[model samples]
Target: MKNIFKLSILGLGLALTLASCSPEDPIGSKVTYYPLITVNGDDFMSVEEGGTFNDPGAVATIGDEEVPVTTTYEGRFRGQTYNSTLGTSVADLYTASYAATNEDGFDGVATRTIYVGNTGDLVTSIEGLYRSTVTRNGALTAQYTDMEYVLIWKNSDGTYEISDAFGGYYDLGRAYGVGYITPGGVIVANDIPTNNFSFPGTQYNSGFGAPSEITAMTVDPATNSIDLTVVWTTTTTYTFQIHLDQVQL
Candidate 1:
């Protein structure tokens, strides 16, 4: 009886292990990787200084903790460093942690979907209509709500021009006081405000700024979707991660 019970337990363990394996997802029962995003019908690749391949992958941050992803590059995890070379295709849904990387590299978990590619999809490439919300901190007390404007991006030359004909507003105010004394009365004071008006707030605010540099771009062979990250250097540094489902017209 004892031998039968031990055999039964061992067989159940083996069955469970076999059930967890699949030919389709040899890595596990389910595949884990990154989603792809395409822009302008192009597959973006992560290249080096001379546009050389960098073994694209991704990164994710949950709360204040950053969870680095595993890819074809050398990465450190749990204080141990390891290198991941390119190999067979993996799963799309990563283990429920903080982050996952497929072919795209160093992107936030929130920005992961932008990298997931679809066939023949190209990204917007920081051109055409792009709106950014501008906020000021420390000394400057102002907020520009959803500044909409037309943008012309020069990816190769690394420059961009913006035209937001609609001018914004700057609040201004002042104070005045007057005092009068009568023969038999004490002093009387009065203050009056004189200027009060509004501006049309539409003017040609033309300026040229360095266009965002495309640090990385890639496309899946299966799905032609492209994923890219454009880093913009302005008075206020800003980063825009782009994933275009289709090429911009």
Candidate 2:
């Protein structure tokens, strides 16, 4: 009976040791994993008004294999009419959705945003008052600085106009005559006025001294900002850069 009892205890100890040596349950044994869907390429895009939209395509992945996905786009011009009081045309916000489901019945989704507008209507899109910072010789100086507000509007002849009050010598207003949009979406000023000098609010002539020209200009709709490189002749030829922030009002 003693020997039998000792053998039973020995068997129980061996069973416990074998259980401890067994491998752990497989990783994520109780968790369910779903396929991951990723939309490739630029999620945001632009299209000309009345133009067809082309999908950039997307991909869905399940484990190590690629799965089929469906992509769809829907857009409408939210504001179709122009507000004369506001001097701005309504913008069209476009949206696209991508969706996919794996064989295991898990679904994934992605989305995109787009802007649709007329190709040459930048003048209307950018008509408003803007806060500007003019940097000359890599520094902010009192002379030739119009750091407050600049006005931009669409002219009757379909060109764009920019008015920078106190932008010229002796605090005279600098009126940029007319600006047109290039095929590449750049805004080029027709010519810089050399003799235009007037105090904006007081109607006083401050007298202009030299000629200035806007050498280059670019607009970024994403940031609501305009960057300009302007060249002017004074005692010496000087180049300045203007960074403008569009004011909502």
Candidate 3:
């Protein structure tokens, strides 16, 4: 049995060597050491509305040798779409990527998140933790009960930007996840106006339609909840209802 085990180990090592060795190498050699990038500041960073963003940048190294890194501040979610000047008075999400290329022409990249939000009186009044649920086409899509996974906070002139807009769906309802929030404009008589919001990993049928039929949009902390109706896969009928129930800050 011991001899059999040794033979198996020898066979596995041979297979690994054969897999690793290339025609050019003729030996099992690791790929060229690429530069590793590290972002300097917090992975999740924010800039208040009407404020400026100054990236702390990043560093790159190949072992002990320093290597040049290429950095970018993306203003849009769709790849590297860069707008001339990033607007501050809107609920916008962005990304910061640091990349270092090796001599072998391979790229090593690191990514972080950026949120543009407002810390206004109206926002503070409505920001809190909550029970949550989401539905598409009148069918349940997601929910959270025992744990208060829904968090809504912050604001902007064009939209009130917060943690998670999907409650607990697209990003586990975490602020630092792949999700961000945008409830647009100022509130008058506690009426939430129509707004368009988009997030990652969703393929909506048409455009992300308006949040038209809001059942309960309020600023009262004790019994605060939001019932938002949006058009989803079946366009025009307002087929999606995502809500923040029993809000508590």
The TM-score of predicted model 2 comes to: 0.35
lDDT of 3: 0.52
lDDT tens digits by residue: candidate 1, 1-249: 999999999999999999888466445364344433222222332211222233334444434344555342221100122244321121011111123444344343321111111112213222232232332221222333333222222223332222221111111100110111000101111110211112111122123334334344443323333233344455765443333232332
**Model 3 compared with the native: what TM-score?**
0.52
TM-score of each: 0.19, 0.35, 0.52
C-alpha RMSD of candidate 2: 14.9
Better of 1 and 2 by lDDT: 2
Candidates 2 and 3 compared: the better one by TM-score is 3
Rank by TM-score, highest first. Answer: 3, 2, 1
lDDT of each: 0.28, 0.51, 0.52
Q: Put down candidate 2 lDDT per residue, 2-28, tens digits, no spaces.
A: 999999999999999999999998776
lDDT of 1 at 34: 46
For candidate 2, what is the total of clashing residue pairs?
0
Instruction: Give the least accurate 10-residue stretch of model 3, judged by summed lDDT.
Output: 198-207
Instruction: Name the runs in model 3 displaced over 4 angstroms.
Output: 1-31, 76-90, 123-132, 136-216, 222-225, 231-239, 245-249
Name the top TM-score candidate: 3
